[model samples]
Target: MQTPRDFTELSMISKTRWQDEELQYFQHALSQILPYINSEGLTILHEINKEIYTRAEKQDSQYT
Candidate 1:
């Protein structure tokens, strides 16, 4: 299980700009910690997932 500090750091990161690779790295990290995280962490995870999906959709549209 991760500490609250871990979730806090991830939450901060989610609010900033993310490169594609960085987003993938954190996304995987969130998935690994999901089972052990609190409600706030879950909320951060959902926010990150939404960002990932939004970015993917934008990229796909550019190619279409």
Candidate 2:
């Protein structure tokens, strides 16, 4: 899957809908799911988010 940033670069209508729908879906899904995630998993996910952005910026960062 394209990193989330790829969706942000789309047209306003698309970005808006993405923020509105897909983001909401992910948020809701995460909400239902995060409680089941251990702290280590949470930390790993945080790192993944950081890595995704870093990769987006320089296009050279390897995702951990």
Candidate 3:
């Protein structure tokens, strides 16, 4: 029988897996249109890039 903790961990793992799959799908879609984004999409992509850069900096700081 699964304990409550086991169920919670499994739920989190499932959510993470779903998120990773979605991210991959979006990445592949983006790769198809290599340099032809509209203005609004460009803005959104810029925000995403900024967020990724910020998170990478935070992770680097943690390791340093």
Candidate 4:
């Protein structure tokens, strides 16, 4: 699948529709490339993952 060239196109879709398998595939793909990516790419991934996990933790706490 082709990704949108514009960042705004990403906001048009809902991430809630993503399947666990698709998330796992992306995570695995990122892990494989982590070793080859430059520092800037690594920093970007780290920041994004940090936000994702932080939001997930907050959501989980709300259910408890």
Per-residue lDDT tens digits of candidate 1, residues 1-64? Answer: 3222444454556444656665677678879988899997787778778888998899899999
Clashes of each: 0, 0, 0, 0
C-alpha TM-scores of all predictions: 0.71, 0.39, 0.51, 0.52
Candidate 2 Cα misplacement greater than 4 A, ranges: 1-32, 59-64
Question: On residues 1-64, what C-alpha lDDT tens digit does candidate 2 reach at each position?
Answer: 3335342353234222343334444444445678798886566445445544544666554542
The order by descending TM-score is 1, 4, 3, 2
In angstroms, the error of model 1 at 20 is 1.7
Q: Which candidate is the best by TM-score?
A: 1
Candidate 3 worst ten-residue window by lDDT: 1-10
Q: What is the C-alpha lDDT of each candidate?
A: 0.71, 0.48, 0.49, 0.55
lDDT score, residue 24, model 1? 71
Of 2 and 4, the candidate ranking higher by TM-score:
4
Q: How accurate is candidate 1 locally (lDDT)?
A: 0.71
> Compared with the true structure, what per-residue lDDT tens digits does model 3 show for residues 1-64?
2222332353345322333334344445555774897886565445445555566688799999
Model 3 score (lDDT): 0.49
Error of 2 at 54 (Å): 0.2
The candidate 1 region of ten consecutive residues with least summed lDDT is 1-10
User: What's the TM for model 3?
Assistant: 0.51
Ranking of predictions according to lDDT: 1, 4, 3, 2
How high a TM-score does candidate 2 get?
0.39
Model 2, C-alpha of 55: deviation from truth (Å): 0.7
